[model samples]
Target: MQFLLDSADRQRLSLDARPDGALTLVFDEATGEQASVAPRTLLWYKLACTLPAKLPPAIVRDYATKTFKPAQAYGALLNTLGPCR
Candidate 1:
């Protein structure tokens, strides 16, 4: 998953899969800093920016009320983010 932040500097952020199969957050900066985060950790932030706000109430309610194990939630988030290149 990739994002172009809407700030004055317009930073780029993406979730990339490393050659070792580990997931990493890649920052497109001069220093090329990268970090790995647990799926549960990512869930704490509102990571679903691609979702539409106009979704139906029932769908929204279902999403909000649903429970998931850490790994499951992470898989769901990955699905929402779509496939990484």
Candidate 2:
């Protein structure tokens, strides 16, 4: 399962992979340590960006809701960002 973030601007984008099978966040442009985020945490990042305002509020109530892990899914979300890093 991969995740893709499609916004109005395509250039300002990124790609990441969880080779170890652990959820990981890969920024399109390496921002040092800041770019690497936990697989589950990346879900939060995605939600904060795309989901409806109401959805986030509800999600906050239960921090463990539908959190996808990198291990569970291979190089997912990589294609979304374009190429792998």
lDDT of 1 by residue, 1-85 (tens): 2322233367566665444445566665677786764444553133434333244456445655346343344455456444432
lDDT of 2 by residue, 26-83 (tens): 4454564324444345554663345232323333454333684432232244323322
| Candidate 2 lDDT for residue 60 | 43
Residues forming the 10-long window of minimal summed lDDT in candidate 1: 44-53
RMSD of model 2 against the true structure: 12.2
Clashing residue pairs for model 1: none
After superposition on all C-alphas, the RMSD of every candidate to the true structure, in Å, is 11.1, 12.2
TM per prediction: 0.36, 0.28
In model 2, the runs with Cα more than 4 Å from the true position are 1-11, 23-34, 39-85
Clashing pairs in 2: 2-77, 3-77, 14-28, 21-71, 23-39
Global fold similarity of model 1 (TM-score): 0.36
Sliding window of 10 residues with minimal summed lDDT for model 2: 76-85
TM-score of 2: 0.28
